[model samples]
Target: MSTTSQLAKRFREVLLDGLWIANTNFKDQLSNVNMEQATAKIGSLNSIAMLTFHIDYYIAGLSNVFEGGKLEIRDQYSFDLPPLESEEQWENLKSKLWKDAEKFAALLEQMPDSKMNEGFVDEKYGTYLRNIDGMIEHCYYHLGQITLIKKLLKQKESV
Candidate 1:
């Protein structure tokens, strides 16, 4: 296969790894979490709802860059999620995450292999490929946090 095909396949693999694949993915980690559970705070760490929004915040920003838009994100505001007051609100956040993940994967599939090595936005941010890979790593890092928080919440409930 051509390099472009290989790159596309790699991109899909990373995306799938983040979204599915049993124990590694958010689909199972976020499973059956109600609004209250999501918003539950354990100690000083961020709530699951906040972490979910934070993950999607980065995805949405990078996705804008891939779509030829500017990256309009700020670190200070990434975790500023509104209250997940109801199941409907939590569902909406989850829906947005799934849709954005799909859109991001589609964008990757359409990317030209030649452009992967090009600088993303500016040289300071590194190459497009690096940024994309970073997104996957970032998700997993936060996914671990989310999973731990969920487990802690469950333990608290059981006690």
Candidate 2:
């Protein structure tokens, strides 16, 4: 497979359906979590919903760039999830994440391998490959946190 195709596959593995790395994807983990559980606090760590929004924030931002738009995502507002007071809101967040993830993967797959060596946005951010790889790594890092948080919430419930 081409590099971009491989990268897209890896990206999907974390957010959508592949079970090679963590044995769990965001869709699987977030599917069963209700609004209360998603927004529940587990000590100093971010809630599941917050993490979901955080990742989606970046995914959507980068996707814009891939679609010929500017890179407009700022780190300060990445975690700025709107009030998820109801089940409908929580579902919306997950739905957006899934949709954005799919879009991001599709964009990546369509990219030419030659573009991978070019700088992403500007020279300071590194190559396109670097940024894409970083995103996959970032997702896995947060995915682990989400998994642990779910376990902790489950443990708390049984207590």
For residues 1-159, write the lDDT of model 2, one tens digit per residue: 999999999999999998999998999989899999999999999999999999999999999999999999999999998878899999999999999999999999999999999999998999999999999999999999999999999999999
**CA lDDT of each prediction against the hidden true structure:** 0.78, 0.96
Which one wins on TM-score?
Answer: 2
Q: For residues 1-159, could you state the per-residue lDDT of candidate 1 as single tens digits? A: 645455444544443443443255665666688999998889999988898899889888988988999989989999989877789999899878877877887787778888889999989999988888788778778878887898899899999
**Candidate 2 stretches greater than 4 Å from native:** none
What is the alpha-carbon lDDT of model 1 when measured against the actual structure?
Answer: 0.78
Model number with the top lDDT: 2
| Candidate 2: residue 135 lDDT (0-100) | 99
Total backbone collisions for each predicted model: 0, 0
- Deviation in Å, model 1, residue 150 alpha carbon: 1.2
